[model samples]
Target: MVKCCSAIGCASRCLPNSKLKGLTFHVFPTDENIKKKWVLAMKRLDVNAAGIWEPKKGDVLCSRHFKKTDFDRSTPNIKLKPGVIPSIFESPYQFQEHSYSVMDSPKKLKHKLDHVISELEDTKESLQNVLDREKHFQKSLRKTIRELKEECLISEDTARRLDVFCWECCQESTE
Candidate 1:
């Protein structure tokens, strides 16, 4: 069966002459993360349900949607490189991910968008803080474990004999 480009506004197909020009058809990536990306590149909001896209068996994208680096042409059968994503799209509508409410003026829309961006930034900052704290806690926990292991072999001693308190936690407040 002839595979066609699944991307929006693309009509390229795997024809006799198409292959002579190095045109190739690629199935959607089996990797869920990569497959989602290809689906998003299709620029069809209707393709996804519950924020996930499930590609049909016939779903395929042509070579024109990717950069040269996206493919590994070294082998006789050209294959896509690891983690390569489709970057090219023909439709102008593909780039839009948001639409302002009809009730709002342009200025109001801009203000609302700015407010949403600020909230996103704040959330990102908070998530980073939590991750930073987790990293530091892990580091301190590792240090404590190392010390305890050194004092009494963890395998043999069962870590009961060694005082297991974290050094960072026990330290006097510098402030």
Candidate 2:
């Protein structure tokens, strides 16, 4: 006869004695010397989560748990609240995308604002340089014109020449 797993939500049945059912059993306390070790081991096999164990008659204990008995010993004492599943597993891709979206979503707006501020600063700086150069050029041209007039080097007929010279000098100053 086979026994069904007493574990909640588990439908696994006990290994059958028939070859088809494929159940294997080992002699309990395989060695007299190991018996003491196993007895000590079983004391530690505590499954905290399941709170119980359903073992079949003559079932060989797994070697992995040979040293420890209470299978649920390390599991947390966490109980699911009413109407809620105990496990919460999210897809890896969804978690990756969600993390990216959370971290990157705000950066988009911040980057745009930073660009705008930089453009404004550049514009302000360029305008100030232009204004400063213009003022210097105006002052230099006025002084040059006043000197030429006082020295009688500038005549009404040479007005165009003076204008050309002043324009070239102003351009050179800017460069």
Candidate 3:
């Protein structure tokens, strides 16, 4: 019943723990080709165990191996999309030292920082625009409700006047 991340370096267990919150375990794909692809990818990560063992149905890979893009998150519960494969891995370091060599150079680090700041500013602007649109919609809805109430009042007043006029005319004709 105990589930743990199948990734070689990951120690994430699927037990209820503060650190492991939101983590999910995924079963190996049922399709033969996809299963083979997953097994190959796992083998690549576990170089020592390569070609030694094959993954079966009961074997599971944890969420850490996948990027957010790898899963379809439109539904309440996230699901792996059909034909999509997990390529990301949970290594010891957050990022591989060789890949993040830009951090070692002052100029490259500054450029990366600037790029991150620009992205953050763009995201903030986009969020503000969405909030403004929601406020406008709420104002329009309130105005529409007020207009409907006024129209209803006018309609009731017209109907009452017509009824009184008919009563007067009927009384005169009877006289």
| Per-residue lDDT of candidate 2, residues 1-175 (tens digit) | 5544322333445454422553222233544455444434343223554433323345343222222222233435322122221121223244445544346657786997899999999999998898798878777877787788778888855755776777787778667
Which segments of model 2 are wrong by more than 4 Å? Answer: 1-104, 156-175
**Which pairs of residues collide in candidate 2?**
44-70, 45-69, 45-70, 45-71, 46-70, 46-72, 46-73, 47-72, 48-72
Candidate 3: 10-residue stretch with minimal lDDT: 94-103
RMSD of 2: 22.9
**Model 3 misplaced regions, further than 4 Å:** 17-20, 44-52, 90-175
lDDT, candidates in the order shown: 0.74, 0.49, 0.69
Worst 10 residues of 2 by lDDT: 80-89
How many Å off is the CA of 93 in candidate 1?
A: 2.0
Winning model by TM-score = 1
TM-score winner, 1 or 2? 1
The residue pairs found clashing in candidate 3 are: none
Residue 140 of candidate 1: its Cα lDDT?
72
Q: Using TM-score as the measure, what is the rank order of every candidate, best first?
A: 1, 3, 2
Number of clashing pairs per prediction, in order:
0, 9, 0
Q: Pick the candidate with the highest lDDT.
A: 1
Cα RMSDs, all models: 17.2, 22.9, 18.9
